[model samples]
Each structure stands twice: as C-alpha cells, then as structure tokens.
Target: MNDVYRIIVNHSQLISFWDFAEQPGQEAVAKGPFPYRLTEMAGPIERVEDGPFGAAAQVKLGQWWNLPRHACPELNFHGKDAKLTVLAWLKRENIPNRGCEAIAGIWNETEKKRQYCMFVNLNIWDSADQVCGHVSAVGGPTPGYKYCMTSAIGSTPIVKEEWHCVAFTYDGQYAKVYLDGVLDEREDFNPYLYDSGLFDGGDDGANFTVAAVHRSNEMGNFYTGAIGGLAVFKEALGEDELAELCKITV
Candidate 1:
C-alpha cells in the first residue's frame, strides 16, 4: 500500500476514502468503514492514469458523483458537537461559468438542506480563487444573506491545472481550510468561528455529492477538474497529520 492511502486508512476517525482508481463502467468505490460507492451522474467521467494517488477521474461541466443519503448514514454529521473533515487531491481547471466550484459534501441549497461543503472561489466576502470550508447549522442560507456567508476561506488561490491538496475541518467551534496541507491563513477567514454546530437533515436530507452542488433548483457550481482522491473523517484532523498526508506520493 502507498504511504498516502496507508496513513488515511490508519486514521481512527476515518469514515470513507476514495482513491479514484475505478475503471470505466465501474462505480467509484470507497475504502474504510461505511464504504459506499459513488455513481456517476449527468454523464460519464473519464479516468486518467497520470495521478499522484493513483488513477484519477476527470469530471467536466454537468458531471458529478452521487450517493443516496439513506445509504450513507454515517456521513450525516449533525448536533452541537459535530466534528468533521473533508480532504481532496485535485487538478483544477477553468470552467465556462467562472463561478464557485463545489468539491464535496452534503450541501443542497435547492431544498435548504445545507450541512457542510468544501468549495473553491466561493465569490463571497470578496473571495475569489481560494479554498473555502462552508458550514451551516440552520441547513439553509445564513440569516439576512442570499447565500451562506459563514465559511473559512484560505488566502492562496488554487491555481488551475496543478495537483493540489485541499482540505477542510470543523471542530464544533471553528471551520478551517487548508491548502496543500498548510493553513493558508487569512484575517478572520482562515479559522471562521461558529459554535452552533451542524444541522440534522433527518429523513429528508440532501444526498452526498461530489464535484457539484444543488443550487438554483438544479445542480450547479460544478468543479471541472481531475480528482485523484477524496476522504472524509468524523473527527477533525490535526495540521501535522494533514501535512504528512500531503507529503506522500503515488
């Protein structure tokens, strides 16, 4: 096993991990406990061999991966003390829309079932081309805003067509965004504070999605790029551990 995959699997709080090594006509299988599969949606995604983790999946506009909410119960993080982590290795690409790009999580703005999501260039608070960790306790837009404004945004813009490690962690009190395993500090944005906790979407929650999010009554905010790997943990990961993961190669 490679060091990257080994370290992720060894993490005690790991909920799911996907190396994006699946072949055509196969689902994106996940490792760790609750190893659910992500079915391709909208259209077929191309699998490329050149990747850091292993084979990578290239998702274009209108393409994404999906898993039903009922099947992945462990991913439904909620309550006042809810802690979570989401990590991804991606090669960014410029999309036609030039809007915010959604990486992963259970954020469905269409039905007001927003829990948590990892996004890039969120275009809020004067942010552009930066990693963003969005958290919502109300499962909807932040009060008095058209969209959720509570998020931890990194200062560094993720360059296009480069392999980068992006991650987010929420430890009940703060939401933090990491770029290439380092905390890309920003004034009051890198570690956004919100102590209210996550929202429990209950029986009618949004499905876990990758590369896109439901908004404006449809799936938008698509991330057009190559994804080498993705992982989720129930507990927030420390800086040292995330840095170690970023150091590993294929």
Candidate 2:
C-alpha cells in the first residue's frame, strides 16, 4: 500500500512542476487512502516541434506528443462517494476551423456509444464556436444521455499561442471548469440521466483516454500543441484549494 495523507488542519495539498519532475513514475503522489491510481497514457516528457506558432511541443499518451486516438490511456480510480479532479497545461498551436475536442476527464468506450468520462471540447461544427464541458455515466439513460454544461471561452478566438492551464472538478452531482485556475463554469447534473446505470468502472472492458476523444473528422484528428503537468485528485477540491490550483504558473 502507498502512503496516504489524511485531511488534517493546515495540511497543504499542493503539487508543482518540481513535484512532477522529481517523481519518475506515473503513480507519483498518493494523496489519500482512496482506491485510485494515476496512470500515464504516455510518459511524462515529450518534444516540441515547429508549427504555426513558430515552435511547439507535444505530449501524448505513453511518450507524449502523439495525441491519444482511442480510449486506451487514462488514470483509473475506483471508489464510491468519491470526488475527482484533473489538471493539465495546454498550449494550442493550431486551432482547426473544424470541430475538435480537448478531453480532460474519464472516458468510456463501448460498441454502442463513446462516452467522454469527463471532458471540455471545442465545438467547431458548422462555423459555430463553443467550449463545452460534459461528463457521462457509462450505460446511463440508454447511452449518450450524460449530463453536459458549456460556456463560451472567448468571444474571439482563444489562439494566442501561449500555454494555459485547464482544470476540472466533480463532487458527484456537480462539475466545474477552470481556466488557469479561475472558475470558468459550473454545472449541476441531473441524477436521472445517470439513474439508468452507473459507470461500468474500469473493468467493464472499457478504457479512458486523455487530451482527445475517439472519433475524428475531416477538419482534424489530433490536437496540435504542447501539453504538460497533468494531475488527478480523488475529491472535489474546496474553494481555497481551487484558488490555489488556479495559481499554477506555467
């Protein structure tokens, strides 16, 4: 068993780039006694290459910068009445005119439906631009009936070619989105949407992927950019914690 930290008074739960660098393996920090493990679809390091933004870096599952195509790479956690959070640094080099999704949650794939366990996607269908967030309880409500919440990230294009930190937190009923540590959006999901079924867990022959979803369109198949400093937590971080997480300096 890994060393688990208990929630105590004045306990500082903070993770930094230095912490990530120091830990060579994927299962670096075991925050609590929760039944979860942080697994890297790809390793911690990747390379940056020349792109639309002069020079750029890429991070993919397993080795970084390959763009996870399918539901193969993910961080798996198992427990009831649990909260979860995921954090990542993204630098978009090429924002496709077409639709694309930058995922940051649990993903489940089945023969019938492709569920983004939790996600924040850039919707670019029919010239409509939107930044939407969603979470799904696998096999719930006949599949694909998961709860979703969305808000416009920016009125204009958000392609400044700089790194940004995106974080997501869930308290079972509600989910919140954060940009560079600031609360961008919050959603209260309908329980009935998930009443039909619960997540099949990681054992239902389902796998999760990060950064991108499974399907692709003519517009683009992968996200062209540099991604780094991804982290996951088991509980919904409180307001103070959220504030601290937002302070990440990339």
Candidate 3:
C-alpha cells in the first residue's frame, strides 16, 4: 500500500480517481474510495495503450466524461488550509479551434458557475498570442464564477500527439500552472476583492465533468485529446515532486 496516501483526515484525503487501467471495454467506472463515477459520457472516451499512469483514456470532438454532483468531497476543502492539486497526463495532437480547451474542472455549467479549472487558452480576446495553460481558483454561488487567474508561461501549439503532464495548484496563497512539471504561470488569490463565500465544499447538486465543460446548450468546448491517470490531491506538491510526477514509467 502507498503509505503516502494513508494519512488520516477524518475522510479520505484522495477523493477522485480514474485510472482507465483495470477497466477495459466498459464505458465509465469510478475506481476510487468515494462513489465518484465517470458515469456520464457525452461521446466515446476510448481506452488506449501507453497511458500516463498505467493505461489511458482518449476523447475526441464530442467525447467526454462526468462525475455526478457532490461526488467530490475534497473540493469542499472544509477547514483545511492546504493546497488543492489537479494533475493529468494529456496528449492533444489536434484542437477543434482557438476557443477554450478544458482539461477537467469542478464546474456547474448550467448555472454558468465553476469552482476551479485548468484549461488551454489561445489568447483570443487577450493580447497574449501564445497557447498556454490557464488556471483559476473561482468563488461562486452567485452570478458568474468569480476568480483569480494565472495564465501563459509555456511554448505555443501545445505539444501535439505527445504525452505531457499538466498540473495546477491552489495553496490558499497563490495559483500556479505547471507544464511537464515546470511552473509556468503563478498568480495570487484575491479574496477581499470579492464579497462571496470562499470555500464552501461544493454543490451537492453539481457534477464533475471531464474533457467537457458543457459550456453552452449545444455542449461545446469539448477537448479533443487523450488523458491518463487523472487524480486530485488534498495537498499541493513541491516543484521537484511535480517534475518527478511527470516522469513516465518505462
């Protein structure tokens, strides 16, 4: 057993897990301690070889997965001041457009609110014209998702047809995005500027969707790529460890 993950916290610190390894031919399944499931499949998230962790899953234009609401208790954060980390192995050889390429998120799109997310930006409306990672720690239960964002710190074209480890961290103090284990962008969290609740666990009625954010009624913003070993950790990882995490087992 991995003793590193056994730290007692009144609840399982590692909440969501989907390896796409043990389960083959099946459409969706949740292999974690919590009852979290990739129960919702918009398209066909096919299983492929040479996964980032063990085995990997791939998605195309309309392909996606989702976790039913309140299934992610770790997102709530409770009284814990530790950082929240999202790490995934991505291989996007093709992109539909220069809009928003969402990796994964704790978002409730129907209400136009997102708790937190890591995405690829083409700098459409902004001056920056590079393809970069966009990380956000958003606060909501209101009109739109209010957030402090950290963006743009890597090369363009976003690495095609290759396995790259992408990560984002929210340590209560700052938000940082990592590409291939390198810290690319960093921004501080602004709480005083917003007059809403900061961390309130999450919505019980919400759902965790992968590869798809359900951006509009047509269900656009779908990520056309492959992802392996998507995991959420309660604690933020150091730079060295983040680099090490990106290393694939050969």
Question: Highest TM-score: which candidate?
Answer: 1
- What is each predicted model's overall lDDT from 0 to 1? 0.89, 0.41, 0.56
Relative to the true structure, candidate 1 reaches a TM of: 0.97
By lDDT, the best candidate is 1
TM-score ranking of the models: 1, 3, 2
List the candidates' TM-scores in order.
0.97, 0.57, 0.73
Candidate 2, superposed: residue stretches over 4 Å from native? 1-46, 49-74, 77-80, 109-118, 124-132, 140-159, 186-198, 216-221
Q: Put down candidate 2 lDDT per residue, 138-183, tens digits, no spaces.
A: 4233323332222223222334366666666656655555666566
Off by over 4 Å in 3: 1-13, 22-35, 77-82, 95-98, 122-157, 185-205
Native-to-model Cα distance after best TM-score fit, residue 71 in candidate 3, in Å: 2.7
lDDT: worst 10-residue window of model 1? 241-250
Error of 2 at 167 (Å): 0.8
Please give the lDDT score for candidate 3: 0.56
lDDT of 1 by residue, 1-250 (tens): 6878888877789999998888765788899986899999876789888678778998877789999999899999888989999999988876544798999999999999999999998999889999999999998889999888889999998888889999999999999999988988999988898899988899999999999999999999999889989999998888988898877531
Residue 183 of model 2 has an lDDT of 60
